[model samples]
Target chain A: MRLISLTAIAAITAFPLFAHADDRIEDALEARHGYMTMLAINMGTLAGMAKGEIEYDEAAASTAGANIEALGNYAVSDLFIEGTANGEVDDSDALPAIWENPDDFVQKFADLGEAAAGAGEAVKGGQANVGPVVQKLGGTCKVCHDDYRKKD
Target chain B: MAEDQARRVRIWDPALRAFHWLLALLVVANWLLGKFGPNIMTLHFWLGYSIVALLAFRLIWGIIGPESARFSSLFHHPRSVTGYLRDMVKREPSHWPGHNPLGALAVIAMLLVLIWQVGTGLIADPEDFVNVGPLANKVGSDIATKADAWHALGADLILIFVLMHIAAILFYRIWKNEDLIRPMLTGWKWVRRR
Candidate 1:
């Protein structure tokens, strides 16, 4: 009877740790999702203007570019903590390959930051400059997404 | 007498040849860009537009092009397709200057699937509401979602069909001693007079 009580106590104590870890993972996933969504929103605006699908409004482009550039400056490594890779969380598009090749994955983020900076500068120069810079910026996203993100 | 011994025929016209190779190149390049080139949707959109244009040309050409390139000349009845398959199993396949029955089916299938693929792309919206197709905004969110799903599924189907098409060409080359690819490249094939 004493042994049974001890086992029950251990189970009760261990449960919270698991729950806490899960909660942290969920938070991380939510943070990353918001980060990507913001990036996409900014990207879409720039892309629409670049393609002539929308009228080129310099103010809007500059604002979007600054947003992206700022977001790029974020320390994204913290946003993708342990247990955020695929299979660990629901709706995570991150592949295990990101963890497997940490250096390359991190390098892609660095590239994205650089490209975002270029985009910010290009937007100030107006339409012609924005297209190529946005292309470069998008390419960085593809680089990370192709290798590190899971396809749906 | 020596020249008469091997009769060579021009089966594929220059326009058809150019269309075939250009389409192949564009498809491969666009796929790479789609898979690996992010934010380069400008180029991606242009590539897709080119593909749609080429497909449109091909469709019209298939209707009114040369004798060998016409759909009426290539498409065969189901019985003929089944018969060709049976003969292929026996290692005694028939020959045509243009696509054979089975090859014809593959060509038609690929063209139709690609048309569907490009059509879906015209209305697809990636990332909820961002980076959408040109016509995506005109359609509602539900339709956009359906188009996106079909676009994703269509990409895989295209890959499968392309691989199978390559495998079939290789199979014919090794097993039946046919040079299907060579004819496509050179637009000429040696035909035996009956």
Candidate 2:
């Protein structure tokens, strides 16, 4: 009877820890995934406006560019970075290649963040200044996606 | 009497066959349009709606359709799928008439994927630039953005699966002489010796 009670107490104590850990990982992944995808999208939107496919509106353009730039400050460690090598979570399309070639991936991310910051500056400066900034930002996205993002 | 039984074999139903080819054509066209230019996006939307409608009809039909077309008739145990795979690898004769286990799983997976994709697209907003799904406003902007991301990813995965499926068919055709594509196109299989 004493052993059974001890076993039950241990089960109760340990269950929540495992559950909490799993939930934390999942929640973190979802948040990071949502943020990174938004980064891609905001960049794409700016590029679209610059290319004339989308009409430029002052408020939306400024907001999008600022959002893109702000994403650079988001802590990379908050993301499930370790899983890119193992596919633990499908947060990023970033393949095993990202970890295999870590230097290249970090460089690309840095370049993307830099271009985005520039784009944010340009958009904040004036609508007319954003086109060139967007072009630079868009180019980085394509480069990273082509090299790091797994096809299909 | 045994020879006469050969004349009675029919595999897929007419509606099911029509749905299969039409969905295939529309899916391919949609992929090509997304590839080529943004101009075909309007066509892609209509085609997507059509796919949703076809899926709805298929879901209903699968319940009421002929024995071969019914879901209950085709879906088999995982062990059966393993056996089927083994037979496929060995080029052994298959006895079951309806969709083989692998094909049934593929069909279900395809439909489920399409459903998730189109459903997510309904609430997706691609920054309101060239494309925003019909029901984007229904969801909050944050949710919509997330859904848009999923929609794009789903489409990409679908493309991957379709390519894999085609490759498998081709492999079967060339390596095993199955001619799997022709039956979906023609709704008729070559006579097999029982």
Candidate 3:
């Protein structure tokens, strides 16, 4: 009778855990994906100005830089919760390496924020400064993507 | 007296050794700047230019430097490379004053691939046209895009070659009891008496 009661309790707890797991994983995946998409859009604006393809409007560049900096400073760890890696969450491009090497992943994310802040400062310095900072910022994105994000 | 005379032989010249280490340092530093250093693209560009200049010097040195440093002295025919591998498998003693046949191939391969890497970098641009190469503006956007693709591909290839180079050095050290790294650093290798 004791064993039966214990088994009944285990089933009751395990079922709810399994039922909610998928929802939580999907929510985290969508949050991170949306965040990255926003970053890419702002990055595109800075890139255009840097390339001389778009006229160097100081205000526009500053706005884009600020946007990127704000996005980079977001609480990224909460968005990349456990079990949201590539196979675990549908539509997630995050590699399992991010979870396996959490400390390195966190460090790389911190680097992105720092680079973004530098880029924001560079935007006020005109074309020569903005161009290189944009490049440097892109490099930080590559560093994280290379190790933590899954390839298409 | 004979044993003492053969105890050490000059292999890599000072110029060659300097070139090897300086190039290695620049490559690693430039890679780090790209990956981690924001607001430092100016330094990255200067580093790339320096690498190009060093490579130019190496080319001329390969022609006129000491015999051991010359390409003609280092290169081997395919059959000779195969024979060297066979000898290696048989554990026969082979003491090359400079690079062995296989090492020669790696050196040449690295040089050629690096040439490709820098060449593409000269004409490429980062995404959305940011941080373009010096010559990128002169080329059409289509051509620059192509160069960008090749530049990325070349970077990966360089990484593979560098890893292979290190692994080979470690293998020689551990398996063949040859201290290849020390000779490169000191510009001298111990040769057995003939």
> Number of the top candidate by DockQ?
1
Question: Total clashes, candidate 2?
Answer: 0
Which residues of candidate 1, in runs, are more than 4 Å off? A1-15, A48-61, A118-122, A125-133, B1-18, B29-45, B65-77, B89-93, B120-133, B136-163, B170-174, B181-194
Q: Grade the docking of candidate 1.
A: incorrect
lDDT of 3 at B76: 88
User: lDDT tens digits, residues B1-194, model 2?
Assistant: 66534332566778988988888888888766655634315677888898888898889888999877888966899998898787787563343366878988988888889899889878876552335577876897878878867887887889988998999787777776676666666666644443
All candidates' chain B TM-scores are 0.90, 0.87, 0.89
lDDT of 2 at A141: 60
Against the correct fold, how does model 1 do in TM-score? 0.75
lDDT of 1 at A65: 90
Better of 1 and 2 by DockQ: 1
CAPRI class of candidate 2: incorrect
lDDT of 3 by residue, A1-152 (tens): 99999999999989988889877877777878788878878887887777777888888888888898998788798889988888876777789998899999999888888888755667986876677768768877766765776543
Instruction: Name the candidate that leads on lDDT.
Output: 1
* lDDT tens per residue, model 1, A26-134: 8899989999989988988888788787778888898889899999889898789988988987888899988999999889999989878745657876677667767
